[model samples]
Target: MFALRRLSTVALSGARCKHSLPDLPYAYEALEPIISRDIMTLHHQKHHATYVNNLNATEEKLSQAISKCDVSTAISLEPALRFNGGGHLNHTIFWETLSPKCTEASKDLMVAITESFGSFDAMKELLSAAAVGVQGSGWAWLGYDPKIKRLRIAQCANQDPLEATTGLKPLFGIDVWEHAYYLQYKNVRADYVKAIFEVTNWEAVSKRYSKAAC
Candidate 1:
């Protein structure tokens, strides 16, 4: 398992890195049945791309504010920074969270799950419930509390990034935004949330967990 460098980059360096929409690791139709080609296409090309573009624009404005030593303007740009930056961060993790390959959790991850929520199945149910209960557009996350060295389940409203908002290193995330599932699942958000695990990239998730534990 490797470190979650991509998410680290997303969380820490996006504004400085000249953000761009990452290419899908697999074909759009690869996650078929769980997510249709049309949904994936629109989600990545349109939605994720918009976040990237907006993040760049936000950072440019922020840089100008900083150059002028304009504290108020820089502070005002904080909302835009967090919104567009969090949107970019969240979607970056979301893309890597799903895959055509159905990899099983590593032994380390399973142990952590057992310790945190009794069992892998139980953890899934808990996370799914969190995803379903999101009042509106949001995200459900399996995160690691580095300070306490424990696993935790958390949900965030809108595009709020997990680490920035809660100090939890996000190991896995489920995006419950309407655009994420509306086209294929319609208003059945719960069904879409439950079905995402079918294409879950556990190897990637395990890698993130391993890194977070360190």
Candidate 2:
């Protein structure tokens, strides 16, 4: 009986460890005018969901290797875990950092942006340019440098997590993957970049900044 109970516990733990797609706070259509419903639906339900699923699958294989002390198999799973885990993390933050309603920058976030970039407008220009200039599929971010106690703009190629690549803490991010804007804005990525700000959730970004600072 005890052996059976132990086995059940291990199985349950493994099942609970699997990565799952997180639900958005708002409806798929809520971000309209800036991001179309179709884009949000497909991007979240399909693209991000795929990453979460794959990450879970890869991690399961990795766990089995670790339990057996198979170093080579563990090492072989690194790339998939990084790619898929980073995708899940980045997309999670991306969805949270936006809203349909236009909001003023939070006092804390605004102050940091002003102090670091000299003004919010400057930061916007810099971040927007980075978003538009990504050579391929990537992301543009407004991140906080804890060591410098300042804000900075950075870019990541593919699905690399911002914090993992740079020491900066991501506050807000914009997805530059063609899949992000191709359907609605087509090849006019500049327009997509321009429109994204209209719905930027400064409140959420501010919370992220505050948490990172802590």
Candidate 3:
């Protein structure tokens, strides 16, 4: 698993700080055929990078506002903080939850999926439908509901972080934003959603599930 730096920590620190874009675990060409090299390069280097840069800038301003006790300025910065922070967090998890090659779910995860959604295929079906059904740019998530010890499928519009928006620990996320698929699949979002499964990093997701379950 990648060492994910949770963006919420940086946002709440109230100190001048910078959040750098994370390097991809695999080369941009790794997930090729399913997700093209061009798309991956642009998505990671361009799109996700923008979020990291904006987040660092926003946090710097937030720190200054807090230090001055400028209540109004601090309040005004909340939307920026949430937007950029969510973008950083969502993309960080999205990148890690994907792999160049297909992988299988851990045994424990398979059992949990059976209990939660009847079968592993059923979970994929639900998650795919949710991802394709998104109205616009957003993410479809398979999240762990700790209170019930169950897996749940949920969608978050735009860059909204799944955990913050739905109180579910994000185990796997499918980014349905245009930037994620437009270059490779054109306007056919469903095709992109369907193809992403070929490279789904189930091992990483299973680890996340285990942690969230605990």
Give the C-alpha miss distance for residue 82 in model 1, angstroms: 1.0
Candidate 3 stretches with Cα past 4 Å from truth are 1-17
Q: Rate the local accuracy (lDDT) of all candidates.
A: 0.89, 0.90, 0.90
Better model by lDDT: candidate 1 vs candidate 3: 3
Backbone steric clashes in candidate 3, count: 0
Can you write out model 2's per-residue Cα lDDT over 1-214, one digit (the tens) per residue?
A: 7787667557755675777899998899999978999999999999999999999889878876765668999999988988999999999998888898867788888888889999999999999999999889999999999899989999999998999989899999999998898999999999999999998888899899999988
Mark the regions of model 1 whose C-alpha exceeds 4 Å error after superposition: 1-15
* lDDT per residue (tens digit) for residues 12-65 in model 1: 544566888999889999999899999999999998999889889888777766
* Model 2 ranges with Cα > 4 A deviation: 1-16
Model 2 lDDT-worst window of ten: 7-16
Cα deviation at 142, candidate 1, in Å, is 0.5
**Native-vs-model 3 lDDT?**
0.90
Cα deviation of 51, candidate 2, in Å: 0.5
